[model samples]
Target: MSAYSQQPALLDPLPLSPPKKEDELPVALQDIVTAAITEEVLGTVLERHVQAHKPKEPRVVALTADSISIYYLQPVREYWYLPLKQTHTIRIAPLLPVLPVDASETETAKWVAEIKDRITRFTETKDAPVDRFIPPNHWGDWSGVAVFMGFTLLIAAYLLGVGVVEQFVFTTERRFNIAVAVHCGVLIKRSKDVNEMKDLLDKHWSGDSKGRYLWVITSWIEGWRAVSRLRREIARLNLLIAAAEEETAKGTKKESKKKR
Candidate 1:
């Protein structure tokens, strides 16, 4: 026998437990099992069912070790995931949920405690990324400077009776248009690249506020174009109506003369 054989045969290593199947998971977590498996982060999922808002629909939330995903099943089926590494803030309400009528007071308290403890542990262990807040400028930035210069130029032009300057600068609508144009021009000139503009907007606005502002600006531009097109169409229609009326009048006069 070889030297290795002389020693007692090593016992077979303890077999590792097999991973849990999707069917074995709790009912609340069954829907997200496929998504979790695809992401390869399907370790353990803790779920809670609660109403998202008072008047809105309820949602299911699955909390993993590294991520929290919310599932909305009404009006539409949607899944949203927020990774622990990317989230910056987590706020839990004091009275998070209303327990079922069948649940005892003690059982309800215990359930709420457990949920809060789990969330607290996960957050303490996996901290979200820190945000760097950029201080906003006072009144000496490029935007401010551009606005001041544009206002001064508008006033000077109005005083000198420049072409349509009084009409544009004195009226509320035209003044608003001029201000919007100047501000947009300044923003474009100040931003060296697309990334810079995005960063600047992110620094100033949080969540969907930035997107909302962009949407409003885009809608305004599109609305202006639509209004202009409608005006042109109306003018063309009016001219056609006038020409038809003139032709009808001429035809009536010719018919009356032939009758005489």
Candidate 2:
């Protein structure tokens, strides 16, 4: 006979045993299955749920006025970027409100304690990027060329102003934008700087900065305020979620006990 079979041969079918009730799924699993079925009947968002759970690669992140970048630094550098025309919410840790403290309260000796309560009621948000737009804090405040057009006497004044701004400026003259970034309402990067990170985008990205200026001023004005609020609101929501999860766990335990 050839190796390939053409005739139907004969083997008796194996007897199948009936499923056992004891071998059935647990009560919790049953409940979950029921809920899932109800959801599917009502038109489930299974696609979005699957997409949300898909694994993501580890990469470095950088942001700019126009786009956010995700890139690999080693193993042959590669980049992935998302363009921005919409406002994104981020939490700024560097801008947390500062409280006045006593220096002598610690083991380390200090002759004087800082009593600046007025510093607590700051009118401007802390660690904001527009801080760079303020005079003295403004860029090229050193460029003297950028600011005063390099007039001989103005140069001296600019240099002196720089010293004053550095040595004597209050806590309000924040000159950087370092924060945790969130996209699509999901927090991604823990520590990042929108102002400083843009240099990387400029270097590696070939995209034009075309539509940036249109919303630049308006967005910059609102940027820090949104971050500050988002930070607080996120913290508040976290507490609520934790409480809900705890309550759910308690209810589940009670149901299991009742079933037993």
Candidate 3:
């Protein structure tokens, strides 16, 4: 046979005629991948995200999953259901580079070294908060982590007692997207000052964190520094509140003296 004629049959197109279907696409999705996958997959992809990129003792903003819990370090941080039931599409980008079949051990090591370098891309979602304005560090606050609902409730109680939040909310879903942990009451009662704080949070606090392992903020990885920034922000805000109160007091005192 000629060289072209002698090509392996595997390279040739199959001769069988295929059956044709209707041109109309199905309206409903037969499979809900996230839901269907839930049991088979050991956990959600947050594990993959963390395993690849080790964030600062990595305290970032608390996101909403509406009550589903997962141990952050256990490689299953959080999950939510998507009810897409049509011929739509979602794109996924993996953090870690796929190992080349012929890559050397040195190459593998280098790839591992690049994990931290790859963090920003995975983190900077459209609505993801920025990590630009971490306040100056001081001490002794671990309020970075909380039992998601539990912590917010506690804060609501605290703020309510302090008279900051008269009417409050527990979940932050309606206000911000992809939060790690936030002031629930502040979201509910959005004042100009609160908006400024929110702006600071948006620009400074990162949602890329060690993650709330079991909804508790105890996983301090490389992302720990970020938590310190969060703490510093709390300190700065406290100082500002103090300064505002002092100014208000001074103004009142000056007015009283003038009246006298």
Candidate 4:
């Protein structure tokens, strides 16, 4: 009779019922990876809620006195900064999952793989923005102009000398030719051409007498080639100059509009 009647008056109440699973827990964050942790670490635990993800290198860290803590972070232009004052304790429960087996042995390996994948996103297929054309001025200094002019005049003079020589050879009479031959013999007494000329001619003659004219004609042709090449360069320069002028005019128009 006493045993049933006096259970210490069932004092301390019937001992409170155990709390619900969630209620009994302290402030707990199960799979939290700090900002200093790699995304791979976070992926192991938390289910990421992202519509659009920012591309960035992973690096997260946790500051702890004894337990974990979380703080709100403000977004800067390219990064986020954690608030100094406000923070709450977070209870860490378990290590996150192995994110799909990093296959990569080292962090560097993972980073390299990530970088390669990211680079693929920016291949030639992407329609990236391009800058407007800016023509370069390369006409060079007065000294460069002077150097070019000097060479041009020298070539012209050589050409003129050659043409003059050829004309003299064609127009001179028999007496002038004979006189030239004799003068050439005296100047080129040792030349084989002189000996050959003496044999070819009915009378004494020297082929070496024609050497000057031959040299001049060949030089004239070379000079003409140089002039032709210079013409092409001039045409290219003209096109470039015209483009630069057009750009300059457009820039002026824009400035005028701004002023108005």
Candidate 5:
């Protein structure tokens, strides 16, 4: 026989063992399996969860390793990311394109304590009206009382001014004034002032400003346009972050399996 034919087949099937009871799988293992399948279906969403678990990578540059091993018992690294393709695994020398440092044990402990404290406060404060938005407490009830008193005072003032003074007080005028005041307040808060706006345009607006009218007109246009652009950019970044999270989760699962 030829040497190749004499060699045992690498593809030889292994003996099958009987299935174990459902409860035989450890709870942690079950959770891992569930997460992996979920990540497969979710696609992009896995990244967000992965990010939540990942350590903070300090360097801007990518760090590649032949293989990367993260212990389940240790919180040494943030998380181990694995790729989605079943055919390939980072078992040999996993390339860590990015290596992030996790928070120190002391920092993690402090954060956990703070979070627990906040949660405890929230739970304890739940029954108290002082902590609630529409609490049944005295303070909450006072808001309603104040609102009623305000309307009463307003009506009394209007009656005194209109009936006693014989001044024309149209109902529409009051409504229009209120609406204008509310809308104007919102706009004022949303809008940047002239000088600040001008400075913003000068700092970031990349366009020509040749003449006096052109400079003023361009500055105004560019500033508002820049604000709108910035808003859109922020929204785009949020979407990209969401997508990245999904990939990271899938990667983590593969990393876990490779360890096994």
Candidate 6:
């Protein structure tokens, strides 16, 4: 017998069958597989598809008492449900043109009142979409940091020179105390300005006082020089008012002299 014939018939390898056609798959399975393949080929295909099909108008849904549900249209059609009791904060952009160049005090007051009323309504409403416009945080700007540091160093140098001058009129301890006192006075004045801003926000933005307070603090950090300039203008206005009163009294005296 041949060597091949000596091998056992049971040891013969079986032939493999051909792969199944995609069309041969069950309808449901075919759809699933097709979707997976499409997703693999086009990254974020589902998100694009949803966006293409989604309605132009936004949808508002009223949630049940213990849970809040959010549906996102982008990155995919997804649903998120969170406990209603969870603390959540709403961020808003600082309203620009806060006071118009030509705006009167009454107009500014009315605008603030309207904003407060809107915020109050937003807090009370359920499942309302809040449009947020976030302003860029300028504290992280390197240019701003450099300018602030330069100004602070200049102020320190000037104060140090003043302290040295005081040494001629005061003891060493007294000179040091005076310098410290002057620096502290400047800071105290700035703090008072910040407090005034906070009070104004509290009066007009009662709904989100914390947010308003934070905005004021950030504004001071970014624009303390501007705040100081505004304070100076107010002082000048007071001086003008006093001068006007003096002029009116002198005119009255001149009229009395003419009558005599």
- Of the two candidates 1 and 4, the one with more favorable lDDT, higher being better, is 1
Each model's C-alpha lDDT?
0.36, 0.26, 0.31, 0.31, 0.32, 0.36
For 130-214, candidate 4 gives per-residue lDDT tens digits of: 1111111134323443444554454444446656544644344464456556544533532433333223231211224353343
Which parts of model 4 are misplaced by more than 4 Å? 1-221
Poorest lDDT segment (10 consecutive residues) of candidate 1: 40-49
TM-score (all chains, Cα) for each model: 0.20, 0.20, 0.19, 0.18, 0.21, 0.21
Listed per candidate, the RMSD to the true structure in angstroms reads 31.3, 29.6, 27.6, 38.9, 24.2, 34.8
Runs off by more than 4 Å, candidate 6: 1-179, 206-210, 219-260
TM-score of 3: 0.19
- Candidate 1 Cα outliers beyond 4 Å, as residue runs: 1-27, 30-55, 72-117, 120-260
lDDT of 3 by residue, 1-260 (tens): 12222223221111112112342112221121122223212121232221212211111111111111112222222333222111211112221344455767687456434432233332332222232333323342223333334545655565456433323532443432323245434334334334434444545344344222211222121133344344333333322333344466669999999999
Candidate 5 stretches greater than 4 Å from native: 1-96, 100-171, 193-196, 209-228, 231-260
For candidate 2, lDDT tens digit of each residue in 194-223? 332343233322223542331232223333
Error of 2 at 253 (Å): 0.8
lDDT computed for candidate 1: 0.36
Pitting candidate 2 against candidate 5, the one with the higher lDDT is 5
User: Regarding TM-score, does 2 or 5 come out ahead?
Assistant: 5
Q: Which ten residues in a row have the lowest lDDT in candidate 2?
A: 111-120
Number of colliding residue pairs in each model: 0, 1, 21, 6, 16, 0
**After TM-score superposition, what is the CA distance of residue 186 in candidate 4 from its true location, in Å?**
26
lDDT ranking, high to low: 6, 1, 5, 3, 4, 2
Better of 3 and 5 by TM-score: 5
Report the poorest 10 consecutive residues by lDDT, candidate 3: 60-69
